[model samples]
Target: DQQVKQNSPSLSVQEGRISILNCDYTNSMFDYFLWYKKYPAEGPTFLISISSIKDKNEDGRFTVFLNKSAKHLSLHIVPSQPGDSAVYFCAAPYNNNDMRFGAGTRLTVKP
Candidate 1:
């Protein structure tokens, strides 16, 4: 079974607005959450990450929020720019060598 899911396959937002990408997981053992952004021909790059012990983590224009009780996490990008357009994936690590990822959501930021 798929442990993590991104219900929306795509999202669109205007420049300077907020873009929200959501993810849900079924496994309760996951203690770390990570977000990755991928371009068409490049490998996914780590965007942000959060620990289960924290509800929110922010780095400049990007922020990751976690709700352990709901097994949900979201990535928020403020002042969304055209350069930020990419596919976003949410992931959870069950162990050092094992990680589960959500089918990414493609985000489009229009100028």
Candidate 2:
């Protein structure tokens, strides 16, 4: 089964706090990992990615960590702003042609 699960459908945080989103995969063959952020009615934008060969990747306020051995990954947003409120998707592909995605986690940051 090709299921990437985001158990929490949504998360809420106050401004200037750290927001964390978790992801899990059942397939062991997955070799690449990506995190995408989306605003309504638009395609997702790539936030951060980590190859299976690495354990962590970071960009500005965003950070992604992968634990291949445990089949888990997480995205962390530091001092999350209201602008960061959106849906986040975890994606992966074993062959690089098609990527499986989590249902998505919607984050809300209060002002």
Candidate 3:
């Protein structure tokens, strides 16, 4: 069974609009939540992250919110741009040395 899940396979938004991606997790031991953005051929690069102790974290146009009680988290992009279009993954460290990732959500930002 997958510990992390992304129910939405894909999402689309007009440029300069807002984009929201959702993620859920079953494990409570995960204290660190992270978001990664991946282009076609390149590996995923870190976007933003939040500690389980905090409810929200933001960096520039990207923000991550964690709801521990609901076992849910979401990534929000404000004024989404075309360059932001990519497959986004939610992840948390597992086994203290590795990570567990959600299925990923492909975001399309159209001009």
lDDT of each: 0.96, 0.92, 0.95
TM-score of each: 0.98, 0.95, 0.97
lDDT at residue 7 of model 1 (Cα atoms): 97
lDDT of 1 by residue, 1-111 (tens): 889999999999999999999999999999999999999999999999999989999999999999999999999999899999999999999789999999999999999
- Candidates' RMSD to native: 0.6, 1.0, 0.6
Candidate with the larger TM-score of 2 and 3: 3
Over the stretch 39-81, how does candidate 3's per-residue lDDT look in tens digits? 9999999999999889999999998999999999999999899
- What lDDT would candidate 2 get against the real structure? 0.92
Sorted on TM-score, best first, the list reads: 1, 3, 2
Clashes of 2: 0
User: How does model 1 score by TM-score?
Assistant: 0.98
- Name the 10 consecutive residues with the lowest summed lDDT in model 3: 91-100
Per-residue C-alpha lDDT of model 2 across residues 66-100, encoded as one tens digit per residue? 99889999999998999999999999885758889
Candidate 1 all-Cα RMSD: 0.6
For this target, which candidate reaches the highest TM-score against the unseen true structure?
1
Weakest lDDT window of 10 consecutive positions for candidate 2: 91-100
lDDT of 1 at 44: 99
Let me know the TM-score candidate 2 reaches against the reference structure.
0.95
Ranking by lDDT: 1, 3, 2
